[model samples]
Target chain A: MVNEQGYNVALVGATGAVGHKMLETLERKKFPIKQLTLLSSSRSAGKKINFKGEEYTVQEATPESFEGIQIALFSAGGSVSKSLAHEAVARGAVVIDNTSAFRMDENVPLVVPEVNEEDIAKHNGIIANPNCSTIQMVAALKPIQAKFGMSRVIVSTYQAVSGAGNLAIDELKDQSQAFLNGEDMEANLLPVSGDKKHYPIAFNALPQIDVFQENGYTYEEMKMINETKKIMHAPGLPVAATCVRLPFFTSHAESVYVEVADENVTVKDIQSALVNADGIILEDDPSTQTYPTPLSASGKSEVFVGRVRKDLDNAKGFHLWVVSDNLLKGAAWNSVQIAESLIKNNWL
Target chain B: MVNEQGYNVALVGATGAVGHKMLETLERKKFPIKQLTLLSSSRSAGKKINFKGEEYTVQEATPESFEGIQIALFSAGGSVSKSLAHEAVARGAVVIDNTSAFRMDENVPLVVPEVNEEDIAKHNGIIANPNCSTIQMVAALKPIQAKFGMSRVIVSTYQAVSGAGNLAIDELKDQSQAFLNGEDMEANLLPVSGDKKHYPIAFNALPQIDVFQENGYTYEEMKMINETKKIMHAPGLPVAATCVRLPFFTSHAESVYVEVADENVTVKDIQSALVNADGIILEDDPSTQTYPTPLSASGKSEVFVGRVRKDLDNAKGFHLWVVSDNLLKGAAWNSVQIAESLIKNNWL
Candidate 1:
């Protein structure tokens, strides 16, 4: 149904944080489209968004809204995607879901183009975008694993507040202002929006990124662990994660430790492997004091890898620092990239 | 020389961050002080400080300053401690140095009061206080290690800018205001004050805590690794650390992973050991969404431990979240605690 004039595209939840980024990304990449439909929940249905110098009003999404749509990009909440994504698929539109609704579904393919582009073809109707933290780590580690082979991985993340959405971002801003003015600040959303207790993230670090699971691991940490396994196709790989939320507004940085399979693998080997990999930029030079900080990698689509070093004790052990804009390569950009992959492969 | 009445005590770098904390700790602990002599470099000299409703003027420290001083606390720069610690020891004072200069000296005891207070008697003249990050971790891990016998330890730190100095604290505040006001943030003293190419730490996380060493690890990381070995008296224990500076004003939090010697060790056993250990607080209960955060643990002397769990893959492997006031248990309080132990045990 897609022609050279472009596909009939629909953007669902086009008013949320990641959804706004999706619109910008789609416009910046100049993805072809004969028609662009903006859809949202009833609350944001009347909102107007500008795309490619054209004004579009966001309409309330319904099953019939996808009558002639060829591609639908979803960034709404999980329930929205859970209730509406299959309806879009039933109408012959391919859905690229940005929520956790279908990410782990056996029939749905969890895709990170850099790590598993081939998985896109096997999707039944809905293609799942991996978690933001998981996408960045797997993208940075894919090249290393391909070159040296990884057996074990341990990661500790310094995540930003934007991953929790726009409300969390406003909380950080208002809290920071109040903190600076020596006034009391309120915390209604943060660490986990749905969790019982809320904590201030103005000048502090919260170890919990999401609601706790029965296993004592936060949902965010468990997502990083499980999604990494699925994307890497390494179910038996030993992976552990400690996810923490910092005060930054954008980008997530991680301290990753990996044990490679080969004994002769060096940091230089890993660096060289990642330097030329697609969607990864290497910024490591200890002598020059060059490594990626969250601010330095805040507004780009590439996953930055740095601080590569060999462990002193374990011969096969290596350490890496990975950084990327949580909203870009982690969410919006990755989703757009999957859409591009779908078009290039004619999967839609 | 040591009587029930009091003893002559000298406080070096009285105007600096840790030195100020040392003064406060000594005052709070009601340490017996017959005459208090405040010493600093020529730059900070002549400043007046109040102790017990009396004012004491800081004087430029010289070799003669320690002639009758019973206990000398040094927290100036490393070179200052290197230049004057032994001079104080040579005269009649027992030096409790808070700089890295003497921490690694074979004759010096790097003491964490809760971990190894008995080592105080082994000090020739100088007892070195461990680094702020190292002190908190070792204090929390000592009880667990004592009970289970640790085999390997790995730690990643969420350290505060206050650990850098008072100037870094100002920098964080100013830069934060500038960032919120949409102005440029200047970074002159961060990551490492002496290191070149400063980066903004107002709302960011810097992975390089101190200057990079020859092995690519920062001096801060190396200090944590080396100091932990010396304090734990386990030279053969495999330990690794990644030190990062966050945007907090006090307290340092660590994500520690340890492999114990005993296979039957459980999280409950680890919690029991830390709950009863002196200077350790256990705040772990995932069911209740309770865990120790940096802000919650700020200004506290005890090392707060939480998020205790056994690793999914390794039965003997356990994870702990450790937090404490970097200026208190990490430096000033630990130094004063050592002095207290010395008095109680009649070692001085």
Candidate 2:
């Protein structure tokens, strides 16, 4: 299958939300592909997905599915990635997993192309995509950390339901309809699908994103805290997060406060640094009433930064508003970008 | 009207949102009222509102409206408050203003009864009510500050549309309906009614609240910062805020980070302090998955505090989730409390 034309690529979880985005991103970017294979769990097997007007049948994932595959993208779930990622990697295929399965693995490299693309070369056939919230946040902070040097980062996220998966989006829609009709909403999946005591997300905000960990912080908060440290290679950096799920359908917005190493840094200095950063689009100008909103940033690939301001009392403290499409730059696109980097750099 | 039976009360802007709540709260609490005068702008002057099954017609407010008024509660626009508050005071009526016109005035007392009942005695006839966002935050922080002492405070607010008034509440509902129907939304009065641009707030979050100031912070954010210091009597306290408007219709929630002066203070200590404090409700129990949400905290007169946890990296820093009804505890209830304090202390 890989004789000469191009590399063989397979997409697992092809029928899910982020998986659908992966297929579309591949077709839109015209990624080099000699043969395209689609894989999913048994529940979604035999499903049909079309890319570039070509219908493809999704097959159940198995160990032998990656026999001749040169690259594989995984987005099904943590257990699927844990079981199949190693099998795909053992068969000479590079696995770019979109779950938290291998992110903290000592041998696995957690990659955000805009932040840590160079780490792609050191991956031993498996690179983990960071969390959606962490991806946008680290992308915005990369330039600031590089130019001014960062000591502390405190972020509070206004995240979307889509990050919880396609079912959560449906829940939001159903709850909104019920709310408008003055009926009690039936809640099944929200705040966390695995957690108990579900609450409605229509016209409301839930402070807990993922399940609460032992330390009172949710797992989503921990992901942002740990992934930022690992991606930036600053394990000692002080990072804290409070992740809250809002009623939006897509795009996650963050209010971030960072303390720069240099005390003389100003808001203009930070804005100018982010203006030319890759994968970052600076939209801050209070005079023109310009800033990024979740609706405006939906379906966009670039991380939009705005509301840049200096903390009134602290010379080194500054605040930023960062927004990006959760499915694109946060998951599917980041995974694809890593694969693209691997091919371009001859690292695979 | 000043006979031994009761006192005459004038409710300015009585047909408006907060004004309507003020009237309901006055009637609900069975305040001593020999006579009630409902006042509004020229447009809403002829409207009729019922208090205790008695309908009163709203009259156009003027300088002479306060001639026989023992207490005047002003919930009109800041300009109206600026133009009429002093006139009410000059006619021997103690003015309880719920607008921002006199909040920062050194001669006036910005009162949150639980935190600063003594400040009511210092009022030069006009006792200003703090901004809705500030009122809940300071009330939550008052107990913590009293026990451990606070050196710094940083807050990010998730505000409701009702804080912007009744039209903004209507905008939220209309936009949510439009969003569900797959139609375009019309936003003419949000983020700030007087701001340059309006964005759809249905299923979205806007970081800007009120108009932008010279610095990147909004006037709403500035009010929280300045008002917190004045009401706490800690002029040197370092406070910063990022105010955001969400699509919800009631109850404002805040994610607050405070640096307690005592390094050994723990989450339990703070929770215990709040459990016994006046006008504070402690709803924190991570094991039971209990915390406050906008829908859960709506229509409540007490500030709900929960999600108390210590910062993972800082021993002196703690985080809290504070929620309260924007129209009740944040505005109407606080104003009525000030009047009760004035009456109890014989300051009127």
Candidate 2 lDDT by residue in tens digits, A187-237: 899888887799989988899988888899888999999999999999999
Residue A35: error of model 1 in Å? 1.3
Model 1 lDDT tens row, B273-318: 9999999989998877789998999888899999898888788888
Q: What is the fnat score of candidate 2?
A: 0.65
Give me the iRMSD of candidate 2, please.
Answer: 0.8
Off by over 4 Å in 2: A1-4, B1-4
Clash pairs, candidate 1, are: none
- Estimate how well candidate 1 is docked, as a DockQ score: 0.76
TM-score for chain A, candidates 1 onward in order? 0.98, 0.98
DockQ comparisons of all candidates to the true complex: 0.76, 0.79
Candidate 2: pairs in clash: none
Question: If candidate 2 were superposed on the true structure by all CA atoms, what would the RMSD be?
Answer: 1.6
Return the TM-score for each candidate structure. 0.99, 0.98
Q: Each candidate: what lDDT? A: 0.91, 0.92
lDDT of 1 by residue, A62-162 (tens): 99999999999999889999999999999999999999999889899999999999999999989999999999999998998998898988888899999
- Single out the weakest 10-residue window by summed lDDT for candidate 2 chain A: A1-10
